[model samples]
Target: MPKPPRTRAAALTATALLLSALLAGCGDDGSGDEDLTAQELSWKDCPAPSQAQGGGGSPSPLPDDGTWQCATMKAPRDWDDPKGDTIGIELIRVKSSGDESRRIGSLIFNFGGPGGSGVTTLPAFGDGYEKLRTRYDLVSFDPRGVGRSEPVLCANDQRLDAYFQQDSTPDDGAERTELVDSTKEFNAACEKNSEEMLPHVSTTDAARDMDLMRQVLGDDKLHYFGISYGTELGGVYAHLFPGNVGRAVFDAVVDPTQNAEQGALGQARGFQRALDNFAADCTSKVEDCPIGDTAQDVKDRIAKLLKDLDSKPIEGIFPRQLTQSAATNGIAQALYSKEFWPYLTQGLEEAYDGTGRTLMLLSDSMNGRSENGEYSNIAAANISINCADDKPRYTPEYVERKLPEFRSASNVFGDFLAWSMLSCTDWAVAGAADHPDVGAAGSAPILVVGNTGDPATPYEGARRMVQALGKGVGVELTYRGQGHGAYDSKNKCVQDAVNGYLLDGKVPTAGTVCS
Candidate 1:
């Protein structure tokens, strides 16, 4: 799965609404796009989110009764042929609250996933960014091939439920064949449903779109905030339009140097490290840890539970059962943030007693499945964007060979993530590159924040991003803390540095450390 944004409240609320119910961009610049750049967006009252964007009511008023606005900007569907066809890029924003004279330009955000709906997410967590909104219009969008932005579609929800329920960690040849076949079927569905889009959803295309967005928004420079996969998107934007970058910050940074295989391996290690942290935190609490006696014991018990679920699934939300795959996904989702640790503990405790609602809900959140059985297009977009960006495609045999290495990196997530490498097998469009190029030599200083306990992107990625971005272009900040990103962690130190840089043009010192 792609690294989801750290929207803990939204994820949890989705589950509650579902048990009662259910739950659940690019770039830059310039030449041959004069009409697009000059087009004025028809911003209006926001409508309720579409199913592709994850079904939800329209955004509520801001804390000060400021309404969120929505707009769709037209962009060439194919950057190679700028005038050939057009697609809508869904956008949402709230104007700056402070005096207009004091306001900076728009502060656009990309909350990662490479597949996430920034249109929906911005409002879900708009309050967290209230301070930044004081001086800049907080803007985000559903990049092309995502949400209402000419979304990519795959299998129906019913098929997806079965698809996700399949035994991901095969024990034999037959099971391996089944896994491969299922992946091919999923990819085929994507091609059948979105053939035109498959070829144009590359990160490079999105980067160009962002540049167009910059022009349409009337910003001379792109002031930005990116998290997780968004960081990678931001890096690509900077690389493509170095001179257009203004104040930018990349949190939970993705390593721009690693190829697909290396990236997966890094995540395996990152997630395992987070699991260790979760276990340690659980055991060291003053209250008795209900799940285990020691840190290792906690992990051991989880392994046993998964082992048992492989053969005999547990009761999940009525009619569905929690299989090993679902349990593993749930655990990984919880490991995304320290605030979610308690939910993991509770889910584990409940699973031990044969109930799997909590874990299943977590897995549902991960997969973009809602209580009503409808799904957001996140999974489809994630696969499409990843397959389009990552050049390498893995076969079962290659995955089998790499299993031991993956297992060594993470016994719990090893086989699972290893198998995930086959997501692009038989994909329709050939990928763009081995990995992303984020070398922005002339770009403004971009703050790179890495959390020590981030499971998805990993802490090491921050330094790797800094190095890959070229010296003096990427300034590194270490948050010796937990979660997928730092600023949202409500860490005063991390936020202070980011706020200083973005709001006042005061860049934090290179190699700054915040606890």
Candidate 2:
């Protein structure tokens, strides 16, 4: 199965390097000549999954499971002209199962991956939050160029598989040539197949779509819950439609203040912190401790292992060997959620046993690759959205110059995170929006959640997000724990406070902590 739908968006920061490129698009002010209409969502029974006949994987009738009703609402392909071509906004809804009189309203969700399917993510939340279901209708949609929507398909499975295994940390001129060639090849595939859609699949466009969804759902104001990259979407929506914002929750907040480079570097440091947390926890235990007694010792062992993989890839069940990129991806993916720590330990143990099959599977799952070689549009769409949102150019010279700083930020994962920005460096089209200040100054009280040990979004971003949202309008809720997000984690205090705010508009005081 794919990694939990709460998968993170790529970390592309606005760097000083981008100072030279002129930012093209501006935020949508929701003021236009054409009027928007609320089309009724024609709901229907969701389709069941088509079972696999052979070893091939089962085809999912996603955005819909039998428990919910599904609809495809029409949205403008280009929001600039409301009269322009239309695209389907795939949606799914689960009505309140509680007292009808107590219904709060429809709660819209965006579960982070600029590519993550709300259709897939909402079910996970729905299964856990019974109270949320009773009080409000839960709704989620596949954003433009994502999932069931007009997805951005760049390379096919074979090409992407090769791209994933290519060495990211180039030690020599030949290695750098391979890395650059693979990146350019992937970009060419995207340009070939999705050039038209690639230019428009940005956070600004997605935020406008959210307003249209609000109108169709008959909600006077948006009741939103955005996690991880979803927080960026939520912040964007608030910026564009502050008047329509109501009871919005941004968990695992992205730092709007940071540019693409800062964002990337922040994430690198965040992952390193999470790795340290994992090390600290593992070493404290008598069993399943793959590293040493001290955190630095654990780091040393991991560094040695990654170095070994660089020269000699361990054989795995997958078509490709366990390359360093895949190994790092697997380790980073496991760090997103604490529940996967044991699997990380297991994978590392098996790697020490000379086979990297387990870690390869973890990496594959995180990348949305099925066992039968069927790949989802998550990776493709993620690249397109991020590139469209923040297209910062990077050269071999720039990467080389900044490599030391990146390594300083994160001795283990820094190089990979910094190089992650390379795919967009030569984007076919410029980024749609510069991601202007999203303070959303006049929006209704917005609750921002942050985890102290979050490996992806980082706590500092959440703190900064609150500051950007302005005083009184934004409230900060801190989860003093290790994870990418705070809500739905083990902390009941954070859960109760968020649930109360979403359901009853009760904002927790600033600096609220859930230990």
Candidate 3:
């Protein structure tokens, strides 16, 4: 669901967006060697982007802009439309002030979330990317069904709001009925209203769009940086266009072959890993960690609190009533970054002693809840793109059978997180059966990053992606930290390695673990 720049639900609507981690791993007391496994994951195909500028849906070129310009590139809403009756893709190009003289054409970035919007992303990251900006023009554009572009709309604001607020997790049998029914409703609505766009918003389609963006930019190659789901997009691009591969950095990559089910399972494991880390941090600073000496004790207390909240809503900030599921997510979200550790420890200590406000604030921000009660649009996009792209892993029977496993998977979030999956079940289209295993793409050299304890896009994902990209180099930056997408943090070593690749063609050697 990644938009080139603007977030769909992944980061856009807020709920679906993967929150950015602000710090790195410094301490680990929990049990679960949460760091990425260093085993060399043997990869398969790594294709280069095809630069054969001849047949098959010729891209409509847009005029080059020193600053900002919008041009149309030809694509297919159906892909069977090669006769010039093409889908008009809108492009926005912004130049860096540092690289006018030695500027290469462009370096595109996908922030993930199948629904992520690049158009909406430029304003935030455009400036910080000064290093790469000077080397190449920073290009951002909305993917087909995202911001500024032909957005794929399902239920409008009010309906979506209702759907999101519904309790995703249901403890009792009756509650499960409500969840199933609600999910069915959302799915039906999407099917009825979003018939036109669902089939088109896929990783494959998005990759092709990037190729067109490259062609229109007049560059012979495709240089890209993507996070989370964005990594999925970049990986697919490399598969589809191995010949035109340029400098690439796939930060926090997603293995294209794994479907949402397996991906969700990995995420389930990640949260457990993070929770174990949190417990360790809490226990070490007795004063900071109020939950006894044992990690299991801490988990029990939090679970108990969530259970209490489920029966009776708390009277706190906006929305007035915080759900137990949301509360648990706040904890998981907090674990994504090391900067939040102090506050997270504080929230835990207080919660163990009967206070949950601090943690509530963390959850509120993660879901994009404004001081006023408005949820971000990212939730919508996240549901749409993911649901559409991957087929459902659980059926009524499968979900019922797996309930205990998922419950053990997230504790306070097990139920709600389980329910958050209904969107794909009801989405208008059933996209790829699974992310295409493109190991045979024969793509160019790529750099894959994995943080040891990244709860969001787990380190395993990076390891798997590296194995998936047979020819790419894997740079394992040992964070001894807790967070996702480590490049954004102030880690000089990792930053230097990343910049060297983007600005200069310096790819780190295999097993190049950074501190």
RMSD of each: 2.9, 7.6, 12.1
Q: Pick by lDDT: which candidate is best? A: 1
- Positional deviation of 270 in candidate 1, in angstroms? 0.9
Q: Which portions of model 2 miss their true places by more than 4 Å?
A: 1-36, 48-66, 433-436
The candidates, ranked best first by TM-score, are 1, 2, 3
TM-score of each: 0.96, 0.90, 0.80
> lDDT scores for all predictions?
0.87, 0.75, 0.59
Q: Write the per-residue lDDT of candidate 3 for residues 1-515, one digit (tens) a residue.
A: 11111121233223222223221001111232222222122222211111110001222222233344334444556544433234545455555556367776788877766555555454344545666766787776666666444555556545654554456666677877887887777667656765666677677777887887787676888888777677777877777788888888877656555666566656666666777787777777736455656777877777787778777756434444456655665676676666666666666666655566666666655544443444444444556667656765455566666667767776654555455545465455666666665562556678887777667667777777877777543444444456666676657777788899888788776667766
Provide the lowest-lDDT 10-residue window in model 1. 21-30
Residue clash pairs of candidate 2: 13-259, 13-260, 13-261, 14-259, 14-260, 14-261
- Model 2, 1-515: lDDT tens digits are 11122344221110111111212011122333454564677787644311110012222332323267778777777877777667777787888877779988899988787687666556545665566777888898888888667778888778878877889888889998888878888888889997768877889999999998988888899999898889999998998999999898998888888767777788889889999998889988877466566877888888888999999999865468998888888888778878678777777888877888767877766676656666767787778888788756677778788889989988888888777767676779787544546778789999999999898888998888888887777898889988778876748999899998988778898888899
Scored against the true structure, residue 132 in model 1 reaches a CA lDDT of 96
User: Model 1, 1-515: lDDT tens per residue?
Assistant: 33333333334445444434322122232345367778999899989988888897888889775789999898998888886668889999999998899999999998888778889888888999999988999999998899888899999999999888889999999999898889889999999998989999988998899999999999999999998888999999999999999999999889888888888888889899999999999899999999999999999999899999999999998789999999998898888778778888989999999999989988888888987889988889988999999999888899999999999999999888888899988999999999999999999999999999888898999999999999889999999998788898899999999999999999999989999
Instruction: Please give the TM-score that candidate 1 achieves against the real structure.
Output: 0.96
Model 1 misplaced regions, further than 4 Å: 1-34
> Looking at candidate 3, what is the lDDT of residue 171?
65
**TM-score, cand. 3 vs. native:** 0.80
Model 2, position 143: C-alpha lDDT score: 85
